[model samples]
Target: MKHTISALVKNRPGVLAESSTAFHNNSINITSISCGETENMEVSRMVICAEGSDEDIAKVTKDLQAMDFVIKLDDLARKEFVDRELVLIKVDVNKDSMSQIMQIFEVFRADVVGMGQKTITVELSGDQERVEGLIKILHPFGIKSMCRTGMIALKRGDE
Candidate 1:
Protein backbone atom coordinates (compact mmCIF):
# COMPACT_ATOMS: atom_id res chain seq x y z
CA MET A 1 0.00 0.00 0.00
CA LYS A 2 1.01 3.61 -0.49
CA HIS A 3 1.47 5.71 2.64
CA THR A 4 1.64 9.47 2.43
CA ILE A 5 3.17 11.11 5.48
CA SER A 6 4.33 14.64 6.17
CA ALA A 7 6.72 15.95 8.76
CA LEU A 8 7.48 19.53 9.76
CA VAL A 9 11.08 19.27 10.82
CA LYS A 10 13.79 21.69 11.76
CA ASN A 11 15.57 23.22 8.80
CA ARG A 12 19.02 21.89 9.52
CA PRO A 13 21.57 19.51 8.11
CA GLY A 14 21.14 15.76 8.67
CA VAL A 15 17.45 16.22 9.51
CA LEU A 16 16.36 14.41 6.37
CA ALA A 17 18.79 11.61 7.05
CA GLU A 18 17.44 11.15 10.57
CA SER A 19 13.81 11.26 9.51
CA SER A 20 14.38 8.67 6.79
CA THR A 21 15.87 6.33 9.34
CA ALA A 22 12.40 5.76 10.76
CA PHE A 23 11.18 4.42 7.46
CA HIS A 24 14.28 2.33 7.05
CA ASN A 25 13.80 0.82 10.47
CA ASN A 26 10.29 -0.25 9.51
CA SER A 27 11.56 -1.71 6.20
CA ILE A 28 9.36 0.66 4.23
CA ASN A 29 10.49 1.78 0.78
CA ILE A 30 9.92 5.45 0.16
CA THR A 31 8.63 5.86 -3.37
CA SER A 32 8.96 9.63 -3.45
CA ILE A 33 9.96 12.49 -1.16
CA SER A 34 9.63 16.26 -1.50
CA CYS A 35 10.93 18.77 1.01
CA GLY A 36 10.78 22.55 0.85
CA GLU A 37 10.71 25.64 2.95
CA THR A 38 7.56 26.39 4.90
CA GLU A 39 6.08 29.72 5.97
CA ASN A 40 8.31 29.53 9.02
CA MET A 41 11.94 29.82 8.03
CA GLU A 42 13.06 27.59 10.86
CA VAL A 43 11.14 24.63 9.51
CA SER A 44 10.54 22.71 6.30
CA ARG A 45 7.65 20.52 5.34
CA MET A 46 8.75 17.10 4.12
CA VAL A 47 6.22 14.98 2.29
CA ILE A 48 7.21 11.36 1.85
CA CYS A 49 5.36 8.67 -0.07
CA ALA A 50 6.27 5.18 0.97
CA GLU A 51 5.09 1.70 0.07
CA GLY A 52 4.36 -0.55 3.02
CA SER A 53 1.67 -2.37 4.90
CA ASP A 54 -0.81 -0.44 7.03
CA GLU A 55 0.72 -1.88 10.16
CA ASP A 56 4.30 -1.01 9.18
CA ILE A 57 3.31 2.47 8.08
CA ALA A 58 1.62 3.08 11.40
CA LYS A 59 4.76 2.04 13.23
CA VAL A 60 6.95 4.21 11.01
CA THR A 61 4.82 7.24 11.67
CA LYS A 62 5.03 6.57 15.38
CA ASP A 63 8.81 6.31 15.19
CA LEU A 64 9.05 9.59 13.26
CA GLN A 65 6.89 11.45 15.77
CA ALA A 66 9.20 10.35 18.56
CA MET A 67 12.23 11.91 16.90
CA ASP A 68 13.43 15.20 18.41
CA PHE A 69 13.80 17.05 15.13
CA VAL A 70 10.24 16.36 14.07
CA ILE A 71 8.02 19.24 15.21
CA LYS A 72 4.88 17.69 13.68
CA LEU A 73 3.82 14.69 11.69
CA ASP A 74 0.69 14.31 9.66
CA ASP A 75 -0.54 10.97 8.34
CA LEU A 76 -2.31 12.19 5.23
CA ALA A 77 -4.01 8.85 4.72
CA ARG A 78 -6.11 9.61 7.76
CA LYS A 79 -7.52 12.85 6.40
CA GLU A 80 -8.53 14.74 3.30
CA PHE A 81 -5.45 16.19 1.60
CA VAL A 82 -4.11 17.55 -1.66
CA ASP A 83 -1.08 16.17 -3.49
CA ARG A 84 0.74 17.23 -6.62
CA GLU A 85 3.85 16.41 -8.70
CA LEU A 86 5.81 18.41 -11.18
CA VAL A 87 7.31 16.93 -14.35
CA LEU A 88 9.39 18.24 -17.21
CA ILE A 89 9.12 16.14 -20.37
CA LYS A 90 11.36 16.60 -23.36
CA VAL A 91 9.97 15.14 -26.57
CA ASP A 92 11.25 14.93 -30.09
CA VAL A 93 9.68 17.61 -32.24
CA ASN A 94 9.80 18.35 -35.94
CA LYS A 95 7.75 20.35 -38.39
CA ASP A 96 5.34 17.46 -38.78
CA SER A 97 5.18 16.69 -35.08
CA MET A 98 5.44 20.15 -33.55
CA SER A 99 1.85 21.14 -34.21
CA GLN A 100 0.47 17.87 -32.90
CA ILE A 101 2.65 18.05 -29.81
CA MET A 102 1.56 21.63 -29.20
CA GLN A 103 -2.06 20.54 -29.36
CA ILE A 104 -1.43 17.76 -26.92
CA PHE A 105 0.24 20.19 -24.51
CA GLU A 106 -2.73 22.57 -24.84
CA VAL A 107 -5.17 19.80 -24.01
CA PHE A 108 -3.21 18.88 -20.92
CA ARG A 109 -2.61 22.51 -19.91
CA ALA A 110 1.17 21.92 -20.05
CA ASP A 111 3.63 24.74 -20.64
CA VAL A 112 6.48 24.57 -23.10
CA VAL A 113 9.45 25.48 -20.96
CA GLY A 114 12.25 24.80 -23.40
CA MET A 115 12.80 24.23 -27.09
CA GLY A 116 15.81 22.58 -28.68
CA GLN A 117 16.64 21.96 -32.31
CA LYS A 118 14.91 18.56 -32.23
CA THR A 119 13.12 18.49 -28.88
CA ILE A 120 10.72 20.52 -26.79
CA THR A 121 10.63 20.42 -23.04
CA VAL A 122 7.24 20.88 -21.41
CA GLU A 123 6.39 21.40 -17.77
CA LEU A 124 3.29 20.20 -15.94
CA SER A 125 2.27 20.17 -12.33
CA GLY A 126 -0.83 18.27 -11.31
CA ASP A 127 -2.21 15.21 -9.64
CA GLN A 128 -0.55 11.89 -10.45
CA GLU A 129 -3.25 10.81 -12.84
CA ARG A 130 -3.11 13.99 -14.85
CA VAL A 131 0.67 13.83 -15.08
CA GLU A 132 0.58 10.19 -16.15
CA GLY A 133 -2.06 10.93 -18.75
CA LEU A 134 0.06 13.60 -20.34
CA ILE A 135 3.10 11.35 -20.38
CA LYS A 136 1.14 8.57 -22.02
CA ILE A 137 -0.11 10.94 -24.69
CA LEU A 138 3.32 12.40 -25.30
CA HIS A 139 4.95 8.99 -25.71
CA PRO A 140 3.90 8.88 -29.32
CA PHE A 141 6.06 11.89 -29.97
CA GLY A 142 9.19 10.09 -28.77
CA ILE A 143 10.24 11.27 -25.34
CA LYS A 144 13.87 12.33 -25.18
CA SER A 145 14.05 12.69 -21.43
CA MET A 146 12.08 13.73 -18.38
CA CYS A 147 12.39 14.72 -14.77
CA ARG A 148 9.69 14.55 -12.12
CA THR A 149 9.40 16.03 -8.65
CA GLY A 150 7.65 13.38 -6.66
CA MET A 151 4.47 13.92 -4.70
CA ILE A 152 4.15 16.80 -2.25
CA ALA A 153 1.06 16.93 -0.08
CA LEU A 154 -0.75 18.93 2.59
CA LYS A 155 -3.77 18.06 4.65
CA ARG A 156 -7.01 19.93 4.05
CA GLY A 157 -8.50 22.56 6.38
CA ASP A 158 -7.22 24.20 9.55
CA GLU A 159 -4.87 22.19 11.66
Candidate 2:
Protein backbone atom coordinates (compact mmCIF):
# COMPACT_ATOMS: atom_id res chain seq x y z
CA MET A 1 0.00 0.00 0.00
CA LYS A 2 1.03 3.61 -0.56
CA HIS A 3 1.26 5.80 2.53
CA THR A 4 1.68 9.53 3.01
CA ILE A 5 3.18 10.36 6.38
CA SER A 6 3.59 13.89 7.74
CA ALA A 7 5.92 14.70 10.58
CA LEU A 8 6.33 17.91 12.56
CA VAL A 9 9.82 18.11 14.04
CA LYS A 10 12.20 20.59 15.56
CA ASN A 11 14.07 22.62 12.97
CA ARG A 12 17.55 21.47 13.82
CA PRO A 13 20.38 19.52 12.37
CA GLY A 14 20.10 15.73 12.09
CA VAL A 15 16.31 15.62 12.38
CA LEU A 16 15.89 14.65 8.73
CA ALA A 17 18.74 12.20 8.81
CA GLU A 18 17.47 10.61 12.01
CA SER A 19 13.92 10.25 10.76
CA SER A 20 15.12 8.86 7.43
CA THR A 21 17.31 6.38 9.27
CA ALA A 22 14.35 5.28 11.34
CA PHE A 23 12.36 4.59 8.19
CA HIS A 24 15.31 2.78 6.68
CA ASN A 25 15.77 0.61 9.76
CA ASN A 26 12.12 -0.37 9.52
CA SER A 27 12.61 -1.38 5.86
CA ILE A 28 10.31 1.32 4.52
CA ASN A 29 10.99 2.58 1.02
CA ILE A 30 10.56 6.33 0.76
CA THR A 31 9.17 7.18 -2.64
CA SER A 32 9.09 10.94 -2.07
CA ILE A 33 9.93 13.45 0.66
CA SER A 34 9.58 17.24 1.02
CA CYS A 35 10.24 19.45 4.02
CA GLY A 36 9.88 23.11 4.87
CA GLU A 37 9.70 25.27 7.97
CA THR A 38 6.29 26.17 9.34
CA GLU A 39 5.17 29.59 10.55
CA ASN A 40 7.10 28.83 13.71
CA MET A 41 10.65 28.82 12.36
CA GLU A 42 11.70 26.49 15.12
CA VAL A 43 9.51 23.73 13.72
CA SER A 44 9.48 22.14 10.27
CA ARG A 45 7.02 19.90 8.53
CA MET A 46 8.06 16.88 6.51
CA VAL A 47 5.85 15.05 4.07
CA ILE A 48 6.97 11.57 3.01
CA CYS A 49 5.46 8.99 0.72
CA ALA A 50 6.33 5.33 1.02
CA GLU A 51 5.03 2.05 -0.30
CA GLY A 52 4.92 -0.82 2.15
CA SER A 53 2.68 -3.15 4.05
CA ASP A 54 0.44 -1.58 6.67
CA GLU A 55 2.32 -3.17 9.55
CA ASP A 56 5.67 -1.97 8.29
CA ILE A 57 4.41 1.59 7.84
CA ALA A 58 2.85 1.54 11.27
CA LYS A 59 6.12 0.39 12.80
CA VAL A 60 8.05 3.16 11.08
CA THR A 61 5.55 5.75 12.23
CA LYS A 62 5.76 4.48 15.78
CA ASP A 63 9.55 4.71 15.72
CA LEU A 64 9.47 8.24 14.34
CA GLN A 65 7.04 9.44 17.00
CA ALA A 66 9.33 8.16 19.71
CA MET A 67 12.12 10.50 18.67
CA ASP A 68 12.68 13.58 20.84
CA PHE A 69 12.72 15.97 17.90
CA VAL A 70 9.48 14.66 16.51
CA ILE A 71 6.52 16.65 17.80
CA LYS A 72 3.75 15.02 15.73
CA LEU A 73 3.13 12.35 13.10
CA ASP A 74 0.08 11.90 10.91
CA ASP A 75 -0.68 9.07 8.51
CA LEU A 76 -2.28 11.23 5.84
CA ALA A 77 -2.96 8.32 3.53
CA ARG A 78 -5.85 7.30 5.73
CA LYS A 79 -7.31 10.77 5.90
CA GLU A 80 -8.77 13.31 3.50
CA PHE A 81 -5.97 15.59 2.41
CA VAL A 82 -5.05 18.08 -0.33
CA ASP A 83 -1.79 17.44 -2.17
CA ARG A 84 0.07 18.92 -5.11
CA GLU A 85 3.26 18.55 -7.14
CA LEU A 86 5.12 20.94 -9.37
CA VAL A 87 6.54 19.93 -12.76
CA LEU A 88 8.65 21.76 -15.32
CA ILE A 89 8.96 20.40 -18.82
CA LYS A 90 10.97 21.62 -21.79
CA VAL A 91 9.47 20.59 -25.10
CA ASP A 92 10.77 21.02 -28.60
CA VAL A 93 8.80 23.74 -30.36
CA ASN A 94 8.63 25.21 -33.83
CA LYS A 95 6.27 27.41 -35.83
CA ASP A 96 4.29 24.37 -36.93
CA SER A 97 4.09 22.90 -33.45
CA MET A 98 3.79 26.06 -31.39
CA SER A 99 0.03 26.33 -31.71
CA GLN A 100 -0.49 22.65 -30.92
CA ILE A 101 1.74 22.91 -27.87
CA MET A 102 -0.08 25.99 -26.70
CA GLN A 103 -3.38 24.18 -27.09
CA ILE A 104 -2.07 21.30 -25.04
CA PHE A 105 -0.89 23.68 -22.37
CA GLU A 106 -4.26 25.37 -22.35
CA VAL A 107 -5.97 22.03 -21.93
CA PHE A 108 -3.83 21.26 -18.92
CA ARG A 109 -3.95 24.84 -17.63
CA ALA A 110 -0.15 25.06 -17.66
CA ASP A 111 2.00 28.11 -18.28
CA VAL A 112 4.79 28.75 -20.71
CA VAL A 113 7.52 30.14 -18.52
CA GLY A 114 10.36 30.31 -21.00
CA MET A 115 11.00 30.17 -24.71
CA GLY A 116 14.20 29.32 -26.52
CA GLN A 117 15.20 28.98 -30.14
CA LYS A 118 13.76 25.47 -30.44
CA THR A 119 12.07 24.74 -27.17
CA ILE A 120 9.47 26.13 -24.79
CA THR A 121 9.50 25.44 -21.08
CA VAL A 122 6.17 24.79 -19.39
CA GLU A 123 5.44 24.95 -15.69
CA LEU A 124 2.59 23.14 -14.03
CA SER A 125 1.38 22.56 -10.48
CA GLY A 126 -1.33 20.03 -9.77
CA ASP A 127 -2.02 16.58 -8.43
CA GLN A 128 0.12 13.68 -9.59
CA GLU A 129 -2.40 12.31 -12.04
CA ARG A 130 -2.90 15.63 -13.79
CA VAL A 131 0.81 16.28 -14.02
CA GLU A 132 1.48 12.81 -15.38
CA GLY A 133 -1.30 13.17 -17.87
CA LEU A 134 0.17 16.42 -19.12
CA ILE A 135 3.52 14.73 -19.55
CA LYS A 136 1.90 12.00 -21.60
CA ILE A 137 0.32 14.59 -23.84
CA LEU A 138 3.57 16.48 -24.22
CA HIS A 139 5.62 13.40 -24.96
CA PRO A 140 4.86 13.43 -28.68
CA PHE A 141 6.23 16.94 -28.92
CA GLY A 142 9.67 15.64 -27.91
CA ILE A 143 10.47 16.40 -24.29
CA LYS A 144 13.97 17.77 -23.88
CA SER A 145 14.00 17.83 -20.09
CA MET A 146 11.68 17.63 -17.12
CA CYS A 147 11.73 17.86 -13.34
CA ARG A 148 9.13 17.26 -10.66
CA THR A 149 8.81 18.19 -7.00
CA GLY A 150 7.94 15.70 -4.33
CA MET A 151 4.31 15.60 -3.30
CA ILE A 152 3.29 17.96 -0.46
CA ALA A 153 0.03 17.56 1.39
CA LEU A 154 -2.12 18.89 4.21
CA LYS A 155 -5.23 17.52 5.83
CA ARG A 156 -8.50 18.81 4.37
CA GLY A 157 -11.10 20.75 6.37
CA ASP A 158 -10.60 21.25 10.09
CA GLU A 159 -8.40 18.56 11.49
Candidate with the greatest TM-score versus the true structure: 1
- Measured on C-alpha atoms, candidate 2 has an lDDT of 0.93
Runs of candidate 1 exceeding 4 Å displacement: none
Residue 130, candidate 1: Cα error in Å is 0.6
What's the count of clashing pairs in each model shown? Answer: 0, 0
In order of appearance, the predictions have TM-scores of 0.94, 0.93
**Candidate 1 pairs with clashing backbones:** none
The local lDDT score (0 to 100) that residue 34 gets in candidate 1 is 92
lDDT, residue 16, model 1? 88
